[model samples]
Target: MATAQAAAGRTFTTDIPARLDRLPWSRWHWSIVIGLGTVWILDGLEVTVVGNIASRLSEPGSGLPISSGQVTGTAAALYVAGACVGALFWGRLTDRHGRKKLFMITLAVYLAATALTAVSFSAWWFFLFRFLTGFGIGGEYAAINSAIDELIPSSYRGRVDLVINGSFWIGAVGGSLLSIVALNTDLLPENVGWRLTFALGVVLGLVILLVRRSVPESPRWLLIRGRDREAEEIVASIEQKIEAEKGEPLPEPAGELVIRQRESTSFAEIAHTVFSAYRRRAVLGFSLFVGQAFLYNAITFGFGTILIKFYDIPAGDTGYYFAVIAAGNFVGPLLLGKLFDTVGRRVMISSTYLLSGVLLFGTAWLFSRGSLSAVTLTACWCVVLFFASAGASSAYLTVSEIFPMETRAMSIAFFYALGTAVGGISGPLVFADLTGSGVVGDTVLAFQIGAGLMCAAGLVAAFLAVKAERRSLEDIATPLSVEKAPTAEAVTE
Candidate 1:
């Protein structure tokens, strides 16, 4: 059965089709995962940079002129805005141009914009640059998710993606650590630290670009787009890697072939495509996207402010808080990745949001009573942050796996755009309001509210996730057999 399954999936390994099961860890596959992973990590880092630098950015004489509140708030707003623009514009582009090309395009935008961020003279320049940086970010969600969904092998898909998705925290932690060093030192003005932080973004992007150059374009995409020759080349590359590893010539590509002449695709068609082939999956995906974006935004944007307000901690503590938070984010997904497959997405993800809510609420209460010692505060907060971040990956994992390929980018974009818009708008405003003297006086009631919403979102996801996980991650994203449809086509494929 295993061999049959392997043989049934076709690759471009030869002029004739070869089974794909025999080619696990093909060089091209690894390259795709690595390239996408690098971009994701950087996106997470760049998005969270404002949170790390909020105190300093908002402080007068910090070498940048702005209210810390304004800086943090505006950055949050811009990040979402940029992401919206990217998700909207790039969704179609990713579909039309193919994932690999779109990935490079976004990376270029990200690389250049992030580098220039170091040199902004005023808030306007900084704001505008941050928005442009968001364009890279916007494109990233579409490109990376699309590439990984198509390229990663079936068996290893869940665990590998879970872990790779977790790496986003690495950049966030890196940003926090670097921010700590720059902000704490009298060696450079506050502005210089932020500059360096963004400079490091340039270097990281270059590393990803270097890694990407060795990667092959998606054969699945090439075949679908009617670039059969390029698909064949990509397949040859995969076969070569398998042969080298196995110390034998690799089998050729095989399976039921349904080669169709490619047709031009348009932005408007994305909506039609998404709804037509995989409406249920599309709805679920959009829900997850919106919920995850809202919670993730709150955490990423509001963390620094919360720390500064609640802890009375100085600017350098941004490092400690962010590091701990990023660590939690990274570690939780890793520990939970296998369990996601085992315990099921419904349980793993739903619990993450629910637990995150409980802990966040608890954290708020502790803050209000002045009961949490510094150690306790950090430790408890890390626990909350961990679940939040991990839950985020779980949400993506579920959504990505469930949705069909026909309009994956479009659906993801909708979720991302709406969630960010809502979360981005609400996170700072709500946090500001909750932190006011009138509302539980330093109690994180606002945090509790956000946490509760996360819990609620989790519940909705959990209920829906059974359908998502009805088939394994490796399963083609086909509509349920009994689902109302006149005809069916591949959604997950």
Candidate 2:
């Protein structure tokens, strides 16, 4: 463990990024994955539990005076809005302060908010805590994605990131099952079960926080902050650990990064790098995020309501159907994630988005015609989300990789906040209103909107997605600190 001292404003050349990238995958890597990736499960649980319990919350004896519409529409929108605000607020700090610090702080925010949410005695109280919880999760997105991508080897990065992001659905599946039990009066009282769900999220988060303490800071981040000695030590320690575990010496890292080390990147510089120098990538990131955000929010936030209103399914029983689709979502990324690395990002990303969009359009048409039952509709959702889930996960991968290292977290925050603001915030609100009308036509309209955006984004990805698989981060986009200096200090530790 080293601090950023005695290294600021220095110029140095080191192979920190390359060394980290060349090491073989080991148990050490799995530790990082477990420590950092489990937060998504908490998010998945939060979202799924809310969606599943929408009807129960709207009932007369649910402790809170919230309507189903308020739960799905107003509360959901506030949560997403908070996330957008939180991403912007915390993202800059993450880039300045380091990923480890921001992620730890953000998780604490989420835990505290969720714990308070469980004790809510009024609708406003519940809504306020939901937003606070989202604020924390939003910051987690920026910090974790940047750290995971920077730490993982280029060869394994695509699949690992996708699987980790997709693991959110595992929590969804868990929440869905938990909701069934929570909503069942025989198992637990309505007021008690729902509160317990939020409390459980806090417990899970505490476990993750304990594991996260051992997860190291990003060597790449340290290197750019002029902590070359610290960065070099971390990389060497990782190499030695991996070598000992694998019983072989790691291959020599092939390239050096010559950087003018600075303590932090300014907001103005980050904005220009993302929006000006990499303007095309900015467009691509926006398109991908909007497509996924709208599609997911519209469907997931309102799905239980769909089952209840259209099919007369009980609120407690809805979790069973949701679990099926949640499994499909997780499986899509787990199975297809490798193809992102092997077949190339453009083909896989575009194909998944386009295929899911086309499938959803068909599902919508069938639903409008009243040709499907609840069981058949859930099956259709499983098929559609199988691809959509993978496409959505890639949106994160695309944004995190295409930008320069200096702007990585902020770029993720900017596009995520922007796209989620446009799509995530509005999507749930629109879908809740549309579906709440109990008019088949209104629901169909919502479906078509999500489908069209996904299709449009796929077309954009066809032309704009980066082929970033198996490439070093520096090669993908040169760091802003990179420069040639005749008298540059070289630290080849």
Candidate 3:
């Protein structure tokens, strides 16, 4: 049974936050990870495959009559723009409805759009589908991140979130390998192979949908939405399963958070909460997100173009090099994820950002001098992104954790939209122009710009970062609905 005490103006207290934070890690947590986390993998796969096949889309007989620059620049920017819009649209819905509802809906949107993309006969058709695909993915970022943080125990939240976000690189590895096969003329036709690549994502999304159906809505969200009975029932069910697995009684939960339940939140309250109460966090979040978005968008969307134009590398071989780079990205989060939980968020986040930025600067210098081969250049990228990937993943983790539960999804959406607008869209456009110019110096200058932004963001993180490790979400930022108790006579009708 939930414990609640009446305070002023219908304010009531409950221990839902403490109860969730005290749960043990088990197969249940693994199920949540598999069900929700794999969205990032699908996103990575989609982006990488598109980047790898930019050249194929420009081929005369490939059904699309667009140039390589159009494919990478205009198409990529449209996708990010769609993502920005989708993040805000779906993010508001996620907060108003519920996490489970929006995540499943967004995933469905992605699957349908991606399957349709496989049948595109023109550049406009492809661009429309790509925008829809990004729209779905953008929604996933807000919904999934909020759900994962709210459900996972505080002790495990950092590493779990990082690993899940980093799983995008695992999809990258798969995409890279798949592209090598699909792009091979001897194995399959150019147009058919690229279409098949998108079809594969649909299959993966279907499987994830099945798993997602079994995951429950967040108990914390339910309680705050005035569904305390439902929240209590869900938590009781979870504790039963967990205790059954351990063959021991769970410890009693401590601490209670008092809040006046509200049916819905308004945009004005969200703006005031972010801008007035948590302005510093907003800055930190934007800095980290913009830095990573610029660096990643510049590299992922442009790497294939760089290889083909710069080093005279065959288009088919770009996937092989990309696979090597993807491996490094995956390894960074897998290896360094624990330290974010153990050593704490501020130090680890800043260090990863700074180190990756410094490494990228060195890489830019080497590339400018024409001192690197395709192979050697890829090795340099692997090193730079090993740290950058982890840092990038942490950006999502930070935004999700630092905001109030009521505004968690929207806060993530706002930052992602702003950062991607400024960085993600422009990175591809700038890099595509540089690649089209066929000047190593121009591309090197682009790399330095990405590196400098990363370093500056790292400095901001060092000073403004939230020390949120192993702390309950309520402790990190008290809910807006929380208020001090008044005498019974003072209670409003």
Task: Please tell me which predicted candidate would have the highest TM-score against the true structure.
Answer: 2
Q: What are the TM-scores, per candidate, against the unseen true structure?
A: 0.86, 0.97, 0.96
Residue 226 miss distance in model 1 (angstroms): 1.1
lDDT per residue as tens, model 1, 302-402: 65655566566776776777788688889988887777656667777778888887888888787778788656877887898788877777655665566
Per-candidate local distance difference test: 0.67, 0.90, 0.89
Which sequence of candidate numbers ranks them by lDDT, best first? 2, 3, 1
Model 2, residue pairs in steric clash: none
Question: Per-residue lDDT for 51-88 in model 2, tens only?
Answer: 88888888888899998888888999999999999998
Q: Given candidate 2, what's the lDDT at residue 455?
A: 96
Ten residues in a row with the worst lDDT in model 3?
Answer: 484-493
Q: Which candidate model has the greater TM-score, 2 or 3?
A: 2
Give the Cα-based TM-score of candidate 3 against the true structure: 0.96
